[model samples]
Target: MTTGSVNPRRADTRRNHERILIAAAESLAGSGEVSFNAIAKHAGVGVGTVYRHFPTPEALILAVYRREVRHLVEVVPALLAEHPPEQAFRVWTTDHLAHYMMTKRGLATALRSASATGGDLPANAYEAMVGAVATLLKANVEAGTVRAELEPETVLRGLGGLLYLDSADEWRKQAAALADLLWRGMCTHRD
Candidate 1:
């Protein structure tokens, strides 16, 4: 599909591009490895098409990661619409943690490279995540369901810590427990 100034490609090309992305995500998630040949095979497209579209492995990985991030970001608004703010916030936090854990292996190299270069992740991605958290948090606070002093960034950092811990299952459970604690701490209780 055309995006802004970019003209839409032929239907076949668009399909090929989408196939490549899907294959890339699967490959990356399953093996944490991405090969042009494999992606092309998975996409049922020729290697030439893969190269034409991505040119480099990093580019392909970036595309897959961005696509996943966009999906997660989009879910925020939908969650907010479908549930109470407190519940929505809790569910999104858990989902975000799961997403990060599932993709951590596949994204390690790219994340490291970005860190080494002192570069930020994609701008839209960063903003989208922050906006989602802020929106949820603000709604809860306004409703007297959460603390006014709660900082979205700090909460995110805590979630990250849980994901980064070495004991995966244990840490994930703790993260859930910690989330419960956070909710309790943030909520207003009137005697």
Candidate 2:
């Protein structure tokens, strides 16, 4: 298949792949380990179809993680377009926290298991996150809302630390407070 060419069969395959990923993520987020049959059923596809796309559960898990990470990173531009730079940063940080929390423990364990088996998650996960932060920080700096000397990696590392907190209801509240604190430190004119 050539670049930019539209093949109906390939499009259909991509749709199925996306559906399976979404279903699997939802399953992993809501509860414990989900079987391939359950994922297939949730996706409205047969078991064979799921297997054809992802030969192993590890592959499926990793794919979902990568896709979600990409989505989070890609949303920075849109967020900035809709809100002020400081507001955009806060919104993105909150959204990022929510996404991480939604992925839940089961998906996390699968990622760790896959990494242990040398099917490691992509390093670009961190890079993508830092890049998004950098993009938002740059705009904020230009707008004079954030300090010019701030480092995107510093903010990213701090927020990354929050992702390790216990996944309890109180932790969610704390995470939001921590994000707000981080925003306060980053900004020049605090509200």
Candidate 3:
């Protein structure tokens, strides 16, 4: 009875944590704000639960940021497994990285508003993104889809234009165009 009870509690806690993060992410993405009351209401949990999960707005924002970065890196393998390397790169750029850049702008603003008292975000974001890019590039190179000597950093830089995407406009189409251009630049033989 004790074991079963503890399991349910833990599962509930995990669900609550995810819900809180999702609500917080939506708030940050929309208004660049973090109000515990609003997040709790949006998450359908008590305000105390929001505080229990993240004691401060900074903690919540940082958690959202980390989650975004982790997803950007973690999705690479599944993408490669599901599609050819070239298609995987396009899907990641247009789907994952582009979305991250949009949310990143909001997150950046929220972080700045939170100020130094929140401390700085970890410095591993760029390195982790670069590693993800490198993995994609390696797969493409092995398949002879991309030039062998191309640098992942270079490819990432080319994709950096995604940071300024106009969310209100046709951003998906724009992202696809940008990815197409980058694809042309990286390809050994154009399709």
Candidate 4:
């Protein structure tokens, strides 16, 4: 679509918008900051287009966070295909943790602002992440690989807590340890 087009087709416009969001997320996640000009360059769109799509940095960052969650949701089926249920669960958890770290770096300030204003972050992102985890956990449980007592949401929250620990180095180590603990807790012993 040309820059001056009055109204692009919905699908095409959506594609462009998605591209811009993806580019913005990648740039922000990598650099821990985003510039509109840099995002436009990464998106292969004009700075005006970026402005048209996201009026403020907070809006762009929020969109990027949601996009990251959407991308993570899409990976669930692929991860299931590539790994066993248990392994897939671990892999996806790692991905979720990485996304959390990226989100914390790129959008934490904006998120805090939204909280202060009593604005909710997109709910679908949490639903998608939790749903993916639940699916994987259910699969493992059905396969007799994990304990039925394990709740997917609980495990996810635990992972978040582990990652948010006070010490960065300790947080990483503790996250891994916490994951292992969850795995062991969920595994059924073969007597």
What's the count of clashing pairs in each model shown?
A: 0, 0, 0, 0
**C-alpha-based local distance difference test score of model 4:** 0.73
Q: How do all the candidates rank in terms of lDDT, highest first?
A: 3, 2, 1, 4
Alpha-carbon TM-score of each model against the true structure = 0.72, 0.84, 0.91, 0.73
Highest TM-score against the true fold, candidate:
3
Error of 4 at 45 (Å): 2.2
Best by lDDT: 3
Alpha-carbon runs more than 4 Å astray in model 1: 1-12, 111-124, 165-178
Predicted candidate 1 versus true structure: per-residue lDDT over 1-191, tens digit per residue: 65656345677788899999889877765577888998899999999999999987777777777777777677887888998998887777665645555676666776566455654457677677667678888889887887788888776665565445333356556656767876776787733
RMSD of 1: 4.8
lDDT of 3 by residue, 98-167 (tens): 8888878889877775657755686898899999999999999999999999988888899999988977
Off by over 4 Å in 2: 1-5, 161-176
Ranked by lDDT, the better of candidates 2 and 4 is: 2
On residues 1-191, what C-alpha lDDT tens digit does candidate 2 reach at each position?
47987799999899999999999888877674658999999999999999999998888889888888888888889999999987787777766646565674558888887778778788888888789889998999999988999888898877775655554466666767878888888879868
> What lDDT does the true structure give each of the candidates?
0.73, 0.81, 0.89, 0.73
Ranking by TM-score: 3, 2, 4, 1
RMSD values, in order shown: 4.8, 3.1, 2.1, 5.3
